[model samples]
Target: MSLPPPALRALQGLGAVWTAPNTLIGVLGGLAGMLAGARPYWSRRDCALVFREYPWGPGGAITLGNVILHTGASLEIPCRTYAHQAGHCTEPVIGLHDHERAHVYQYLVLGPFYLPVYLLCGGVSARNPFERAADLYALHGHGWWPLKKR
Candidate 1:
């Protein structure tokens, strides 16, 4: 059921175009982070640009589309300190890069609606379907999309 190579490439190209607005925002945010001493690096595994050691925000990491700004040395480290402090770290730690990459894919699918829909889904809360889906993908390497019930 997977798309053929040419079809997949076309679809991906369309997705990039569709998500360009959000990616622009991500680029702006990345630039700001860079000003704060964050170093940029391309992650082949995540297929996104990462700004490590970002000095602002509430801490940990934030994904603005194809960019991830994180307050850490590397994305391999666990970024969910709040989860651990709240005693909700029962599951294995999920890679921060992978979690943010899920958001990139979400942007590709949702395009201009991604930000509004993300806010409607409860922002950063654990109860948010977007966050849940990201965690699911990070933990299991699939299920990045939040499917609606029929």
Candidate 2:
């Protein structure tokens, strides 16, 4: 059989997409959520939008929602729940805004490997180093969020 066209071969590479797991998931999930009556829009905070409500998860699921971001203040994807949305301005996160943002950076740094790294650290509320960093950002300084509340 003749080899597939160059364009087709290139696009097929997406099947192994690992440069940004969250981003990949976000794009696909966001599209699906959008079609499922959920609206995907960007937030004023420069985050990706996917009019889904990614709450804290059920059955004590720890963290919830689906948001992916690598470098800047942009979030990708949105789940059928509250992924990463606050108001018309920020993500739905309040006390943990900084923490969540840290994860976004992790995605950026780790790219497609972020998911595996995060999982190795601790799936949900396991106090993994990555999570620690985010928590620190919110509780500590130099890159914290809440600022220890004095």
Candidate 3:
């Protein structure tokens, strides 16, 4: 049987994409929130409501519902609802500037390999080394945009 050229084959192979699981979703959201400059910082009570409503997904940390960080992205209480439900996550509901920026951070650090690896591994609970670095950057030092009040 005839076959495509080696170059064509390689390019086709490159086109194949691997999607992440729900577990790993948190990071994406967290990263987005960070970039948008809109973190929850909601009162503990509001946080609880968020948690009760959305519930925590995989590959992230959840405290009642106040905060959600997975991979590099996250969503805080109150605001998270908008981001989560609408798939947008804007201010009043959720700040998108930080979220988008955080995605950039994830792109930079995790690279293309991160998401594929995350999907292959299954479940987002495990904290990969790259994720740890981003988290550290977000927690301690001033990394990128939409700086959250500490």
Candidate 4:
């Protein structure tokens, strides 16, 4: 068989120069979202689920606290569904219970050690080992976890 493209091969590198910047930004945005959404009473099991279930996880869960400190604010989720179809509901659905629970979850997962690591190496490509792992988890949504037959 013919050889694979060089660009594709390079992408496998953790510190690959081409995709590092974008990956770094994604990591940052995820961390910021997590930090701004904290709650004290939330539990650890719940946090792990969020880190496991969502597209944003691992590093995203770790640096959340530091991002919260810099922003000096909280993450505001959309209270209403898109298209302004209905009034705001005070409670979230069960499947979505952990949807916006990033902040507290992040704190639980990494404790106080995540922020500095994020600051020092968040943008480095190799620092994102979990990115591929998370991607593998999400691939199930693309027909891997297809709906059941009636």
The deviation in Å at residue 93 for candidate 4 is: 24
For candidate 4, write residues 56-142 as lDDT tens digits: 333223324212211222222222211122332333322122222332232333445434543454432323322222222232222
Off by over 4 Å in 1: 4-6, 79-89, 148-150
lDDT of 2 by residue, 30-85 (tens): 55545545444544332233334432224211211234222222233222112223
User: Residue-wise lDDT of candidate 3 within 4-101, one digit each (tens)?
Assistant: 78864453233322212322354355445456542433333221111112333443234211233432243342223222344442323333323323
- The better-scoring model by TM-score among 2 and 3 is 2
Error of 1 at 39 (Å): 1.1
TM-score of model 1 relative to the true fold?
0.85
Worst 10-residue lDDT window for candidate 1 reads 77-86
Q: List the residue pairs that clash in candidate 1.
A: none
Structural similarity to truth (TM-score) of each candidate:
0.85, 0.50, 0.26, 0.23
**Alpha carbon deviation, residue 108, candidate 1 (Å):** 0.6
lDDT of 1 by residue, 6-111 (tens): 9976876787688888878887988887888989999866767888988888777887767788888888876552244357666777878778888888987898
Misplaced by over 4 Å in model 3 are 1-74, 77-104, 108-112, 119-123, 142-150
Q: Whose TM-score is greatest here?
A: 1
Overall lDDT per candidate, in order of appearance: 0.79, 0.43, 0.35, 0.30
* Alpha-carbon RMSD, each predicted model: 2.7, 12.8, 16.2, 15.1
Task: Compute the lDDT of residue 19 as modeled in candidate 1.
Answer: 81
How much does candidate 2 score in TM-score? 0.50
